[model samples]
Target: MAFVTTFSTSLRSGEGSSICGSRPLSRPSQRKMVRIFMAQEEQLKRAEDRMKKTVETVKSNFNTVRTGRANASMLDRVVVPYYEVDTPLNQLASISIPSSTTIQIDPYDKSVLGDIERSLMEADLGMNPNSDGSVIRLIVPPLTQERRKEFVKSVKAIAEHGRVAVRNIRRDAIDKYKKAEKDGDMSKDESKTNQDLAQKLTDKYVKTIDGLASEKEKDILKV
Candidate 1:
């Protein structure tokens, strides 16, 4: 009888906690809440990591696209031949911008200057490369109106790829959340909340990609 009375008193105290701005939960229920929170955190972390990578890829792709000014990053995608093996152009030569319109390439080994020049022309970057057996100069021409429009299209495509990557991550996270709910780890309401959080993450990254595209387009279109 004494043990029963003690247990009843504990329940009464817990019930009154809500009036004091707190509520006591059973040990099993507390564990369940913690487990659900951890699962949601894991999903959010995965989504964030995936979205960050996508954003970086978009930035890299933008660098590969040329702007009006001479940029070393324009040569980021150029491949050069080093001893019959394909290599990045930067490895074979030191690149610098001596002027706004010219990219100067000084080969560490003089023999590769010709090969590097030929590669630049073939890359179709629309720049003429001139070499005098020592240093090579690439003159970046002003973009024609038509060329600028084409570049805008290319940047939009790259941004779209980033958005798709982020959306795929959101889809995977939501699927995992739903599966956990089905397996009885959380309630339907909890699963829905987690899914909403993942969707918000997706939306945020998509907006960032759109902003990147807008800025790049503006840069390309600006005279």
Candidate 2:
């Protein structure tokens, strides 16, 4: 198929002539360009989505780590034995943060309170559970200076993991962009531009993860 058809003769009245030493691109070429643009945009969008998910994971992890205050999400990993099968504590009971330092767990069945208490103790959350046969209470003790430092380190590690995830997404996007160039679907210049854009996006997300970790670190370090 002809990508460009030059006019060898001058225009006849209504016949359009190639303007500025250039002819209009053929329909097939225009469609191909559109497809390439769409594909590049899709890769960029996928990279952004991956970065968002990684950041969300980091945020969730920050909530799970111990703080000066009690959080319901801290018990996200707590599982109790219910009828021989391990079940999530939230599924078997209602968890409430009644105060800054207290987490209340009230079992729906009432009979499983003991099991829930046991799970809380064995979970190694560094907090003891008090059960008075009906409701279980977890009084989150104040974090020691040393423990707060430990928490800061832990949250920093999680933030690093998120940054790595964002970088991995960038790598995947660059790979797709390079393949598109190799397959003749896009030009080398297009591939390079996409790679640069992906890198910028990765840097932006990594900075966001760092900021999140820094905020959590401050919270942990605060007296």
Candidate 3:
């Protein structure tokens, strides 16, 4: 009976040692998993930021497209040679909508009035700039059917570029995870999950670009 008790005690001690040994091994693995998760989150954040900027760029480009109405934003792309430096027209002038069909540009420096008018003429906006000494006036014309179709095509192209940019960002993020999995920094399952997330993000931004494009198309064809 004493031998039996001694054997039983030895078995219990062995079990306790085994449990304690497993704790140290598990701790390192748990910390490694946490690190991997944080790294993936950071990558996703960067991808989202880039996608947002792409969306904003699409919006800005859309603003530059002409509609039937007069919008000051249409001149957002006009650059004038001021003091031998190419400068944005908005920086050298005060642009205001005195009427729905008129865009008045009053240059802070009267010397650059001619330069602003010349830039507007060369901007391919299909409008003539009328300079009256100190200010330039632009008469916004009604867009014909053919012109409206052309503007629609332009906005569509802009949206396509934005979608491509977003997809590229997603691809880059997924590639990072693939490299991580290859290097054994993360598991295959984790890498796949991150790639799926990046795809979902890409889809969301692409939908946003489409919406913006559709809205601008409607505006152009509204006349």
Candidate 4:
């Protein structure tokens, strides 16, 4: 009988198929579905990890606040207004740590060297640039009491922005979870479970962000 054959196949399929033979799937079909599900789960996981890494990058950028050190991160987002185009300082020059308190920038284009210096000053990272016609030298000055407070505030703002980005990713994941539910790919209970898992993912990212920020804050506070 067809029903008997269908039941036999369903039993051999190991329970990934739909209940009552409504959408009976063979073992190979179930494995394929599992692979698809795992791929999607891995994609979401990678996205969440990216969010966390972004938070760390932002924190690193803020750590460029430098209590008393010359770090390249401080200039990461500083745009050099070159040839009417905004360019990253690193692209214009080579950044190197000559000393704990000195960062050297050797520009490929001597003409744009001035532009890079100007950009650094404009960024208000509080460093004075010294140029030797070929390489620009930045002397990392000690942080003043008032300036340290301002730097702390700036780092906190960066962390808050990271938190916002992580939350946005969480929202996007929730949307995807809902879409999966609507497509009938996931049952209501499974949808709820995935939603909870997504929230856990968000929380984990947020926690990582917080921990990274805290460590960077300590670095910035070191006198």
Give Cα distance to truth, residue 186, candidate 2, Å: 1.1
- Measured by TM-score, how close is model 2 to the native structure? 0.85
Give the TM-score of each candidate. Answer: 0.82, 0.85, 0.87, 0.78
Query: Candidates ranked by TM-score, best first?
Result: 3, 2, 1, 4
Q: How close is candidate 3 to the true structure, as a TM-score?
A: 0.87
- What is candidate 3's lDDT per residue for 1-223, written digit by digit as tens? 3433453454444432233355532444544545566677889999999999999999999999999999999999999999899999999999999999999999999988888888998998899999879788999999899999999999999999999999999989999999999999878987998899899999999999999999999999997
For model 4 the local lDDT of residue 135 reads 91
Q: Report the CA-based lDDT of candidate 4 relative to the real structure.
A: 0.76
Q: Write the per-residue lDDT of candidate 1 for residues 1-223, one digit (tens) a residue.
A: 3433454455555542232366676656654555566656777787899899999999999988888989999999899888899999998889999999999999898978888988998889999888887999999999999999999999999999899899999999999989989988867987898899898999999999999999999988889
Tens-place lDDT per residue, model 4, 1-223, is 3433454455565653766557777676666556546645765776678786777677666656666677877778788988899988888888899899898999888889888888878888777888888898888888777777777787788878888888888788778878887987666776777678778888887887788778777777788
Error of 4 at 25 (Å): 5.7
Q: lDDT for every model?
A: 0.85, 0.85, 0.87, 0.76
Tens-digit lDDT track for model 2 on 1-223?
1111222111322233343568865555555555566667877988999899999999999988998999998998899999999999999999999999999998999989889988998999989999888889899999999999889889989998888889999999999988989999888987998899999999999999989999999888888
- Flag clash pairs in model 4: none
Model 1 TM-score, all chains together: 0.82
